[model samples]
Each structure stands twice: as C-alpha cells, then as structure tokens.
Target chain A: MAVEDKLKIELGKQGVFVTTVNEIYNWGRKNSVWPLQFGLACCAIEMIATTMARYDLARFGAEVFRPSPRQADLMIISGTITKKMAPQVVRLYNQMAEPRYVIAMGACAISGGPFKQGYNVLKGIDRYIPVDVHIPGCPPRPEALIHAFMTLQAKIDAQPLTGTERPRHLDAAAMSEFPVPTQGAHDLEPPANRLVWPLPAPVASGENCG
Target chain B: MASSPYFSLAILFLAALGFGLAPLGLAVAWAKLVSPAKPNAIKNAIYECGLESKGDAWVQFRSAYYLYAIIFLIFDVEAVFLVPFAVAFTGLGISACVAMLVFVLLLAEGLAWAWAKGVLTWA
Candidate 1:
C-alpha cells in the first residue's frame, strides 16, 4: 500500500488528518504556475520549443503562457536585457500579482550572454528584478528550462508558510518594487544608479566618435 | 415557500450570486491572508517592456477604420437575422420571402455604395 494510503487508514480510526494548509497551498501554487508569454530575444524561440508537443511544458503545469501580467504567476526572462528594455521588464515584473516568480532563462538574461560586452546590454536582469532561478546557456535547451522548473518547484516546496519571515512573495513587508530605468542622452540609466558602467566623458568632442 | 411562482427564481438568483461570489471571495481572502501585500515603489511602477515610457500613450489613428468596423458589424448582424429566415424558409410565407429579399437588396446597395467610394480598397 502507498504510504499516504496507509497513513490515512491508520489516521482514520483516530479521526485525524495530517498536513498543513501551507503545504497544500504551496503545492497548488507550484504546480499551476502560469508564466507570462513575454519573450525577449533568441532564447524566446527555445522557450517556445519547450512548449511544443515533443517537450510539452504542460506536464509540469506551467504551460499556460498568459499575455497579461496580471494573470501570470511567473516571468521567464528569455533573452538579453537591453538597457532600453529593462524598465519595461521591471514594470511587467511589478505588474504581476503577488506570489510571482522569475526564472532568468538563458545566459543572456543571466549575464547578457555573448552580448555582455555590448554597451546597450544590461549585465543581468537580477539587477532590476528579483530572480528566483537562473538557467545559464546562450540559449538553453528546453530540457534546461524543465530542470529549472524542477529547481524552482523545490524552492517553493521548501518555503515556510508560518514563519516570522515568510517567502518574499508571502512576506508583504519584505517585498519592495524595483526602480524603472529611464532613458538618458547616451544610454539608459537606472533610477538609482547607472545600470551600465558610464563611458568616459565624451573625449572633448574633437576626438573621433569611436 | 416552494409553491410560490417566484420562489424558484429567487433561489436561482441566490445560487448564481453564491456561485459567482464564493470563488471570488475565497480567492480574495486567500490572497489577503496567505499572500503578503508588500508594495514598493519599483514593484508598482507601470511596465513598458522594461524601458521607461516616453511621452503620452495616446496616438492618432485614421477614422476610416471605424467606418470599416461599423460596416462589418452591420453585415455580421445581418447574417444572424438571416439564420432564422433560412431555417424557416419552407414555413415562411411569401410575404416573409419578399421582406427578406428587400432586406438583402438594401444591404447589397450599401455594399455597392461602399465599393464605389473605394472603402473596400486597401489603399
């Protein structure tokens, strides 16, 4: 007999059931994580492939790719975060309802991948929004995404429901919004600081615009 | 109470309200009690795909598209009206046939007018 069934049979005589509301709640949330359909760059194509019949993401209950941030439970940062696109990403992250999770889906999203050297690419999405999981690859295979989902599920399963300090999403007091980046004359600047290293002050204009 | 003519309707209304509100109320309560309401300035900011929004959201659009949509709606609704007529064609009187013919002809006239005006052209 299954352990749960055996336990249930024994507990039935005593009129008792074992399990906490938190565990049940976490299980439900982890299983039915609806990811926002937003995708950034090349990694987005791989992200789409994960949802195809061969590698159906539906098996893990995260197949629903919601178009609206209000409806999504997760945001998979699927590509490089350009300085121009950072604010919008943060905003979308902010717009998602509480209990929202983020999975940095590729090396680009994790640390700008090959584009890290590019002036316009943000080093990582984590600088702007809290990332729950990071899957590293130029464009991670669909299997990597599935593995990341498993890791995220493990993280969710470990969260305490009744602690003084709850999970970030569960602890209203701990949750803080990220500042939206603004466009500067030369590049995008985060509200608090320069998102990227500032280029040396315009070399006296007479120099070549190299 | 059960014999009253309005009893069933009253029960149905209450049932409908319960059905709609129960889940909504439960969800709201769960979110409030179980989910934390940590609001920070950054989390609340409007999202424009990560980049800061520029200028007003409003933009100008051609009014011609509205005309096209209105025309489409008129024709779409006309098709709905035709379904019953088509289904009852044998039972419908000659008068009904004449009325439907006039109705179709009137719509055709509108289509021809729109065509002549070049409203149907992509350009």
Candidate 2:
C-alpha cells in the first residue's frame, strides 16, 4: 500500500485524522487545476493527445479545459509563441485568477525550439509572463507532460499558504501584467519603446532599419 | 414544522443564499489572505491576438445566418409545444389530437419550404 494510504489507515485506527489548513488548501488547488483551452502551434497536437482517453488527463483532475482565461488557473504554453501572439498570451495570463500557474510545455515554447533563429519567434514565453515549470522536448510526449505535472505538484506542495513570501499570484508587489508588444513596420515593439512613423535616417550604409 | 408556507420558503431562501455565498466568501478570503495583488500597465491592457486592435469588435455578418437562426427557433419551439401534448396525450380529446396533428403538419410544411429555398444548406 502507498505510504499516504497506510498513514490514513493508521489515523483511522486512532480515531483521528490530522492535517494543516495549508495542506487542505494546497490539496484542493493541486487537484482541480483548470487549464486554459488555448493552443499556439504544432506542440498543441501533443498536448491534445495527453487529454485523450488513452492518456486521460482527467485522472489528475486537470482535464477541465476552460475556454475563457477568467475561469482558468493553469496556462499550458503548449507550442511556439510568435511575436504576433505574445501580447495575447500575456493578456490571457493576466486575466487568469489568483493562484495561477504556467507550464512551458515544449521546446518551442521553452526556448523557441528549431524556430529560435526565426525573426518572428519569441525566444521564450518567460520573457513576458512568469513560468512555473518548463518541459523540454521538440514536442514532449504525453508521458513527459504527465511528469511535468508531477513536478509542478511537488512545487505546489512546498508552498506555504501563509508566509512572508507568498506565491506570485498572491503577491501584490509582483508583476501582474506584461506589456503587449505592438506591431511595428519591421518588428513588434515592446511597450517601453513605442515606434515612430517615417523611418529614421541610418547612420551608415547596410545598417538595418530596426 | 412551521404552519406558514412562507416560513419554509424563508428558510429555503436562507439556505440557498448560504449555499451560494458561503463558498464565494471563503474563496474571496482565501485569495485575499494567500494570493498577492499586483497590477501594471502592460498586464491590464486588452488582448488582440498580440497585435493592437485595429477596429471595433462589431463586424457585419452574412444575412443568411439570421435566417438559419430563425428556422432553428421555429423548430425548437415546435418541439417544446409537442412535449406537453405528448405527456397528456391520453387525457387530451380527439379534437386536441387533431389540432396537434395540424400543428405538426404546419411545422413540417415550414421545414419543407425552408429546405426548398436552400436556407437549410450550410454555406
């Protein structure tokens, strides 16, 4: 028998069961994680496969895929995030309720995979939104995704419900929003640097406009 | 037991309110105590597939979609009307049966008309 089950049986024999409020709170959050039903690129197919009958993501209580960001607590970055899609991704992340988590689910999402060299591909989604876990693979298998979930669960288990340093979602001092990059003539401009119209003069020949 | 029907209703109302509000209150408190609240300019901005929204969300749609919805509503109401007649069939009179038959025929005719007009065909 599993150690927890054995412990539960022992507690039953003693006519008492003991656990902290934090344990119960973490248990509820960990079990019923609702991921946003969003996909970006090829890695999404693998992510979908994980939720199918054969894989059965529901067994971990995370199969409830919400269409709206407001109802989701997990954002599985399941594919490549291009420059054009970064703002929407960040927006969706911002919209998710407190105690939210982000799982970078593939090599493409983690570090842009083979597309890292592409001008339009963002190096990694972590540049904008805070990621809780990173699963590395060209497109990680369903099993790998499950392993990542286990890792995430372990991370959640370690968090203190009430402490000086709370989780990012609960921390009012932490970043709540990421700047949605604006589309410029040549590239997406970060909010810090808004693009000006009428291209500026190049200092030298063969200099890139951007 | 309370003799007044309103008394039971009042208890039920309180129970209903408790049922809805208790969990919501707990969640709000839990979030306030455990979660952090941080807001910034970029995070609060509207999402438009990562790009700035060029135009308003309102856009013209094909008129045929309205026709399709109207047809669906007509059939949906026809089904709703048939349910009561079906449940009380034995209690209903022969005239009532004939009236229902006429109703079904009228709906069938409407469906046939729509089919002939090619409104049923998805474009």
Best by lDDT: 1
CA error at residue B109 for candidate 2, angstroms: 32
* Candidate 1 docking DockQ: 0.36
**Which candidate should be chosen as best, given DockQ against the real structure?**
1
User: Candidate 2 clashing pairs?
Assistant: A170-B35, A170-B36, A171-B36, A172-B37, A177-B43
**Candidates 1 onward: DockQ, in order:** 0.36, 0.25
Q: Write the per-residue lDDT of candidate 1 for residues B1-123, one digit (tens) a residue.
A: 899999999999999999999999999999877666666564454653434456776888987678788679669978998999899999988899999999988888888888888888884
Give the clash count for model 1. 12
User: Over the true interface residues, superposed, what is the Cα RMSD of model 1?
Assistant: 2.9
Give, for candidate 1 chain B, the lowest lDDT window spanning 10 residues. Answer: B43-52
Worst 10 residues of 2 chain A by lDDT: A191-200
* Number of clashes found in candidate 2: 5
